[model samples]
Target: MFPASKQAIGMDLPAGMTLLLTLGVSGLILYLSIRTSWIWRHLPPGPTPLPLLGNIMEIGRSDVANSLKKFSDKYGEVFTIYLGSRPVVVVTGYKQVKEVYLDKADDFLGRGDLPAWNNFYKSQGVIFTDVLEWWRELRGFSISSLRDLGFGKSGTEDGIQEEAHCLVEELKKTKESFIDPQLCLRKAVCNINLSTMFGNRHEYEDKDLVVVLSCIQNTFAAANSSWVQEKANPNSVFTRSHLLSSALQIFFAGVETTSTTLYYSLLILLKYPDICAKFQKEIDHVIGPNRCSTIKDKSSMPYTEALIHEIHRFIDLLPLGVPRKTVREVTLKGYKIPQGINILPLLSSVLKDPTCFKYPAEFNPENFLNEKGEFQKNGAYMPFAAGKRNCLGEPMARMMLFLFLTTIFQNFDLKSSVPFEELDITPLVSGFGNLPRNYKCAFITR
Candidate 1:
């Protein structure tokens, strides 16, 4: 009788445990559903989010750009999307982007939530800081100091010209053999910033230069800039940590974007040899091969300028510009967005908007050219993004693109074994950058 009773008890315990486990899961699902609904109750309508998971599945891991486009099409220009339970207000189209970023710039000056960057930077850098005053001081100091040193001006042209000459010499070593240009171009572009910041540039083979390049790729860069060290203000935001972070921001953001653009420009030119020939023609007529290219020459070479602008538009390097957060509650397009909600300015939509460009989807330099073949500015052209918080490196990047490209073409002609039709120019979209696919091409001396 005792043995039978023990068996009965064991059987009942197992049944009870199974029922309890089922109820616990169901209760958790209910709680999450209610919480998610309450969180996004007043936000703009968007794709339904699942409990715990949010809309990550719908957003898809790799197709975030396309997902945002699809959501905007269904929910209108201003819509909401969940990135792992965090609601991001995605603003698309030029009209809506301009309104949110430009019209309400002050209200949305707060840095948006970026979990990865936030964790690493700990809100120390200018790019990721939510402390508005600190960001202003650093930004002001950086711009003024860099400008004084000739960044984005003729002051830096001699350095760039020297580096471009080195690049041509390096490519000349390839002896017209197909070689990867990524390393050579990256080093050359990075040297421009290094020379400005450190007052010296490294030889391409220098061990320290390799280390610095590695650091830049891994969310860090050297910060021995004289400006940062010269101004000692222990009480101010110019602490060692903050200054180092800012320098890292400049190198990482500036070098990667500029080099990738130059790489894409080469790829695009390789794909369109006729355009390449035209660039050479313009370079010959305006600057000529004997002299180094300068910022002033940009005015005389409309075709070259137009092509570079088209590259920026065509590549859409950063489809979604750095996210911004609402500093205060603001009403936009009849939607009442609460303060602190993350905002994603869909730059790709604006860059590719049908109304903005005649050939927005294709690589056509005519987008920035008139019937007279002179470069013309388009209001929709916001490749570096629009508003006050747009890329601080814009001037430097523009200068580099013009100088590096003109110098390269002036010295060497692009030769690729890949047939024009077979050559793929589509950008390989990474997390935040649209990278050109790896290919080998020869640089024959012109």
Candidate 2:
């Protein structure tokens, strides 16, 4: 019914609408940019970031700890970086890390939301839970339970000693053949946790043990499922799922970090045989050849103790301690951080700080030794981290490291398959934790 001119004009309406939509999008982007600028203006300074992407390109494909060190050098110890659209404040150096985690512990006690962990835990478990009361109760219960189970007590040493013997027997089976020690070490370490937790240890060939290990390895993969459906129910505290989730967290944490540390210690010793000789001499003097080493012998074996501390320092295991969130607004180093800002207490930065250690980059046992050669504790040595939310398995892990290393070194002389120079001590994977590259070593019975 309309005229031909009107029909022609109606056809142009679609084009006009398209143009309006484009303008609206542009305005929205502009507003967002301004908002982002305003938000960042108050935070600590760091590298400039592109809108939406925000420093992802800068941090690409590099070890995050190393990358963060580079940023810390440029932006000072306290600086901010964007992980996608979210701003993460990185606190480096021992002074600053201690200030946030120790001095103002209560202010920085909240847990940051990690997508992968949230999918698995649904805000449950001591490691990832934000429920303050629940975290306190569970943490207390766990510590008490561990103590009751003879963790760090004389009663548990026999079990660890027995496991060490089992490990030695297994290694002896290798009979001088070049073998990658990863699987054996993993099993030994895992079995210790299993024995402690469930009062059962598995043989090397146990299919159930294999299945459990596989599940742990694939935890991040399985996290995306709807297994945490009970999270929505208000009355579901300490439910069956919660118990399993907590157990899984403890098992994974107890096994992976301890085993990886042992692996690194062996690799480092192989690289510096002179250091190894010194370590063995100290061990021989203190523990002798006939009997297994116990935790009580640690005081007399200062060099061996120093070597273990150096391995932890040199390896810089966790690198970035689990990300923390500000429970409320906090003022750190004169910079105001609002509630819910994700914080990374860069433990690697502190571990490698030149002010704290003589040779931060090199693997030196003297870092922990005084001029008199007695083991001196450094305040900066926080391999298990510090404060209220520090690693729950610290006592157990320390015991295992000392017992396992001393037992193995006492019974066998570790020899690398390749020349010392050919050995690669660099981490094969450096995300979440540092994992040493796989290599063959000969465990010759002494």
lDDT per model vs. reference: 0.84, 0.85
- Model 2 ranges off by over 4 Å: 1-21, 216-236
Q: Write the per-residue lDDT of candidate 2 for residues 1-446, one digit (tens) a residue.
A: 95679768767668889789889988887787689879767899988877777887888464988898899989999999887778999999999999888999999998876878898689887788887777886788668867887888886888899999999999999997889898899899988987876678899878866676777635433542443446766775555455556667877998989998998889898999999999888888888999889999998999988888888898988888898999889999999999888899999988988999998989999999999999999999998889999998888898999999999999999999999889888887776777788888999998
Q: For every model shown, what is its TM-score relative to the native structure? A: 0.92, 0.91
Question: Which pairs clash inside model 2?
Answer: none
Task: Mark the regions of model 1 whose C-alpha exceeds 4 Å error after superposition.
Answer: 1-13, 217-235
Per-residue lDDT of 256-365 in model 1, one digit per residue for the tens? Answer: 89988998888899999998999999999998879888888988889999999999999899988889999899998898999899999899899999988999889999
Q: After superposition, how far is residue 333 of candidate 2 from its true place, in Å?
A: 0.9
Q: Looking at model 1, how many pairs of residues clash? A: 0
Each prediction's total of clashing residue pairs, residues at least 3 apart in sequence or on different chains, is: 0, 0
Tell me the lDDT of model 1 at 352: 94
Which ten-residue region of model 2 has the weakest summed lDDT?
Answer: 219-228
